[model samples]
Target chain A: MDHRQEDQFEYQLKSALHRQEPPNGFTVRVLARLEPARPEPWPQPWLHLPSLRWALACALGIAVFAGGWMFQQERRRAEGEAARQQVMLALRITGAKMQLAEARVRHLSER
Target chain B: MKRTLLSVSIVVAAAICAPAQTIKVPESWDKLAAKADDVVNVSLDKKMLQFASKFMEEDENEKHLVSKLNGIYVHSLEFKNEGEFTESDVDPIRTQLQGPEWIHIVDVHNKTERENVVIYLKMVNNQSLGMAILVEEPKELTFVHLDGPISPGDLSDLSGSFGIPKNLHVSEKETSKPKAEIKK
Candidate 1:
């Protein structure tokens, strides 16, 4: 073939290889597969509500109050028990002393 | 009429004279005075040095007043307020108590009220034989001088005078009972 005809053929082959074009039915197939995504119903959104935070804080407060009240009651009970023990000890001592004194008095009377 | 009147007067005089027939006054003031001296001499202020002297003079019956219980020589106890007692007031007493026979027992503090309680006990042969004093200060102060034979077992009894009641069940019952009752 002549050089001019050969050059034209090479140019035509290069252009064909480099050219860009949309694939056949590419856009339509993607749109058909998507099916509108159904919007996902927005995920309930309760975690973001103000009432949930309020409920959590109130529960924590109530738990803390209950713990504090129980602690106070236990402390007071312990104190009362301690006081009772002290009183008991004192009384026992007094009784013993009185008995000793009585013995002495009796001994003296007999003498 | 005159004879009846004279008889009535004689009977009245005899009746009046009957009560005076057996009455007699005894001279016992000297004995009483001596006893008063004994009590005063053994008082807290003067007892320490005088104790040995007075104890020596006690009769057999009176000697038992100073009990030697559990190897302890317990003599007497005296209670007084702090205002009525000064450091100097107790100096002579304390000096005698601190003799070789006695040992320091306990000294405690009330941190909240800044008060103190001091106690001393006497020991012979490593056995508690006597008590010296118990001083408690809580705004007002109470000083107790317990001189007598004491034992470890007697400690509870000694502490009782300060309102520490023994027999918890009995005290509980007594305290729980109402002091007064009302009738509708």
Candidate 2:
């Protein structure tokens, strides 16, 4: 009813509304359950068998040698064919020119 | 003995007689080149000239006028000699015909006779405005220029008489703009 009593009542109501309950042993429960994680075991060393290494090396060598040989063979074959073609072409050209020259000469002689 | 000796001498003489002269065969292109100097210049080939003239004489109204189309010109050709014709032989004519007003679009090589066949097309926009071909054969030379809406496919059709090389490519214009014209 009085100003002081009304002020006290309002303060008490605000305090009651804002008050919070204490947590139920949450920190203790979490600490009790917690345990440090174990570090994973190191991976096993890669297999390095002598036979496997040798087999791999042999395969690579064989592949390289085969590729190189094939390339060389192809190049030589191409060159040989080109040379043969050139010779044939030249012979053909020369023969035609001679024939033409002969015709021209014959015509000139007749005139 | 004297008779036998005479017979032997005659046989030997006959055997020593020179073999008949073998006429060497020349290749088709080589035979063609040997007569190049006598071949008519590209400016004089009657058939090609007629075709070019016909193209130019088309009615202006009937002509397909694309903003990208340009002028057309043609040349008659004959080659009459066997020497290797260089790019220089064709350069003078190309220079005269090509300028700010004209563009160079194609250069094709005829391998059989080692001849350079040059084609110049006039350009407007990015399209072929006109077209021309300079075919230097072993025994003939022909130049053709066409002015109109010419397509690159039309050139493929025109190249039937002469063998077109597989490596033929259309030269690109220097400018990035579509309106840029290609120069020789």
| Model 2 stretches with alpha carbons more than 4 Å out | A1-111, B1-73, B83-89, B100-103, B109-112, B154-184
lDDT of 1: 0.39
Give the worst 10-residue stretch by lDDT in candidate 1 chain A. A83-92
Per-residue lDDT tens digits for candidate 1, residues A31-109, read 8877786566664577568899789789999999999999998875554443333222323333443343333334444
Which candidate leads the pack in DockQ?
1
Query: Among all windows of ten consecutive residues in candidate 1 chain B, which has the lowest summed lDDT?
Result: B1-10
TM-score of each: 0.28, 0.29
On lDDT, the leading prediction is 2
Q: Assess the local accuracy of residue B139 in candidate 1 as a C-alpha lDDT between 0 and 100.
A: 22
Q: Interface RMSD value for candidate 2, one decimal?
A: 21.7
Q: Individual DockQ of the candidates? A: 0.01, 0.00
Give each model's whole-structure lDDT.
0.39, 0.41
Residues A1-111 of candidate 2: C-alpha lDDT, one tens digit per residue: 999999999999999899685699987777777645545555423426777777878999999999999999887555444333322222222223223323333444466
